[model samples]
Target: MAYELTDKDLLDLATGAALLGTGGGGDPLIGRLLVEQALADGCKVRVLDPDELDDDMLVIASAMMGAPTVVLEKVPSGREAVAALRRLEDHLGRQADAVIPMECGGLNSMIPLLVAARADLPVVDGDGMGRAFPELQMETFGVYGVPASPLAIADERGHTAIVATGADNHRTEWFARALTIRMGGSAYIAEYPMTGAQVKRTAIPRTLRLALTLGRTLREAKQEHRDPFDALIDALKQTPYEHGQVLFSGKVTDVSRHVSDGFTQGHALIHGLDSTGTMRIEFRNENLLATVDDRVVAIVPDLITLLDADTATPVTTETLRYGMRVRVFGISTPPIMRTAAALDVFGPAAFGLTQPWQPLEEIAN
Candidate 1:
């Protein structure tokens, strides 16, 4: 069923998207605020099922690209993403019929809603990454054969660029990264033009709603004096993520992170709240690996996230600091994302991890 997102729903949506972001995707706070501001200005965003699309309807996935930390300081104008979409349309010679999110985690999930509301177009319920990933090529659209350009990019200042490098999504990333870095480490983009049929066949389904469900579940759990972690784990059993389990619970002891080549790259250590063992988590914008006691418990392209130990609020990678209590959890990726072909693009190796990709279920056991 199709539904319209009201202002009341934004907070839950942001909360869940941040969790699904797996410690990347800019900040959901920024994303929610942008959507709220747009709604206050009288814009209404409607979400449509991918099945509602005509076979030929044109769809564009819109997103923000750059370091999560940079987005916190350099917020978008809420107009740049629409501009990028328009620029892409001009280059493609056809206006978009609908907007879909490039990824469902974090800030990018809401980016499509903002663009759709401002442009008076509906948004597809699905997305490329069921969870957020750091780079453009990591999306299932790219993994499954969608070309990422003639992609369009825009900065807060109104500059727009069209990047086209044939079928090489990787080369597209190189050019886009350099362009984004020059744009002050953050920018809005529209890419992966697809027909409705293609979208239906390729996109991760219903993750926007999944994020909303997660947030609502956690919030209600807390309100009802239930355990948010248990509630969260139960919620995943009913979603595409399939399952989630706690990996560790402790306080951040040390964080070693730095921004380099347009990514927040580094790791953090968490000391047990009731034990002496320490768990280490690594990242490149998104949480990539979770290690404890020299064992690789979770690795990308699985979903690993840190939440506030008590509140279950997601903790983004850039904000991790020494002494904050955090709970680490890992969830399985959708089957499409775990296929051998998908691993070639976003597996641990894709992120330069030496370990082979294993199911989060297998690793947990």
Candidate 2:
């Protein structure tokens, strides 16, 4: 069933999206505010089921690209996505029947809501990546050979660029990143225009609803004096996620972070408080690897998320601070991300870790 998203649901939506972000999706704080303001200004947004679309309907996925830290500082003009969407439709010479999030984390998840609202289109309750990922081509759409071409990049200053990716999807990310860097480290993008039939086949369906359910579970767990962490695990397991485990509970001990090749690259060390061992996590704009006592606990493609041990609020990679208490969780990626081809793009080695790609389930065993 389709539902209208009112102002009251923004907080939970952002909270849940941030949890699924796995430590990188830009801040949902920013996303929530955008949606909230849009609602306050009286824009009605509706979340629609992917199945509601005609197979021939046109859809486009959109997101903001660049470091989350950068976007936090340079707030968008609020018109960037609509401008990009307009340019994209002009480039394609057809109207987009709907808008969808490129990924279901932090800013990306909510950005589509704004886009769909401004464009007067329905926001699909699905995304390319069921969770957050760093780059444009890391989505299931890219994995399934959906080209990111006729891509539209726009910024707060009204500058828009149309990029043509003829045969290579990697170049799509490279170009978008370059443009975003020049646009002062953040820009809105609209790409991967696909027919409704393609969307049904390749997209992770009902992810926004999933985020909402996860968020509601967390909130209810806390309200009823239940374990929110266990609630989170249960919510995920009941969904297509299927497997989730509490990887560690600790306090931040040390962090090594720096910007390299346009990404926030770093590692964090967490000292065990209850688990009795040190844990290490690595990232590139997103948490990619987690290790405990020199043993790999989780790697890329599978999610390594950290939450405030007490409140269960998500703690992102950029926000990891010394002395903060945290509980880490390892959840299995969707089946779309575990395939040999997907692994080749996002596995441990793709991030330069020499360790072989191992499932978190196997690692737990």
Candidate 3:
């Protein structure tokens, strides 16, 4: 089924995308406004399942790359993704058939919608990462050997740089991050141009709908005065992410944050209210590791999301603070991300942790 996004769906989409962001992916507030404005202007943006396209059709991914803080300070002009897409098409000497999100995080999840509306293309219902990851190369597309170039990165001022060659996705990330820092700490990007077959194979299918569905479930639960955590898990049960489980419920006791290597680096401590333990979460843009009093509970490639204990609102990494009552949930990544090859790129090892990869289901048990 095709879903056409209008102004009304903005809040739900943004809220749900933030939840899936797993404490990173930048805030969705600004991106939400951009998509809302585009929809209000009558720009047609429809979400299509990747399977709806032909195996040979062309599609490209679009997203914002930079410090979440910088993105907030330097709001997008909404032309960066469009500009990058056009440049990529020009390089390929062909028009794209559709647009897909590079990641299913807060800002990124909505970015392709804006680009699709502007480019007059439909946005696919799937994304590279089931959730968000801090780095460009951490996406499922990259994990499956999709090249990250010929890529384009553009700033609000209309300045753009095209990377015609990237040795690998890692090099693409390095170059893009460097250029973004020079482009005033943030820029919109169009990269990983791939075929529909590649998308269907590597992308997490129907994640856009998953995010919105989870958000709607939580919202309805709140209105009905039910346990939103139960609603969230029930929602996940109907999707590919059936491993969702609440790991801890508590109030944040401490937060430590600073910018390291142009990425938000931080850790949050949640003191359990009823569980008699503390949950510590470390992050570099996205939550990479979570532990209970120094024993590993959840690590990278497994989704670790924090939500308000009462309303179930998502608490982004940048907004987490002392004394906020929250519940933390762990959701397993899609099956594609659990392979040995995918783990090497996005596993606990990728985050420089010594622990081995453990499925969230195993940890939950």
* Candidate models: Cα lDDT each: 0.92, 0.86, 0.87
Candidate 3 Cα errors over 4 Å, as ranges: none
Off by over 4 Å in 2: none
The deviation in Å at residue 178 for candidate 1 is 0.5
Q: How do the residues 235-350 of candidate 2 rate in per-residue lDDT, one tens digit apiece?
A: 88788888888999989999898766657779899999876899999888889888889998898888888999999998887788899999998888778888887877777776
Error of 2 at 272 (Å): 0.4
Q: Least accurate stretch of 10 residues (summed lDDT) in model 3?
A: 162-171
Reference-based lDDT, residue 334, model 2: 76
Residue-level lDDT tens digits of model 1 in 1-365: 78999999999999999999999998888878888988999999999998888989999999999999999899787999999999999999999999999998888878999999999999999999889888899989988888998899999999999999989999999999999999999999999999999899889988889999999998999999999999989999998788899999999989999989999999999999889588989999999998888799999999999999978889999888889999998999989998888999999998999988889999877
Cα error, candidate 1, residue 361 (Å): 1.1
Residue 35, candidate 2: C-alpha displacement in angstroms: 0.7
Arrange candidates, best lDDT first: 1, 3, 2
> How many residue-pair clashes does candidate 2 contain?
0
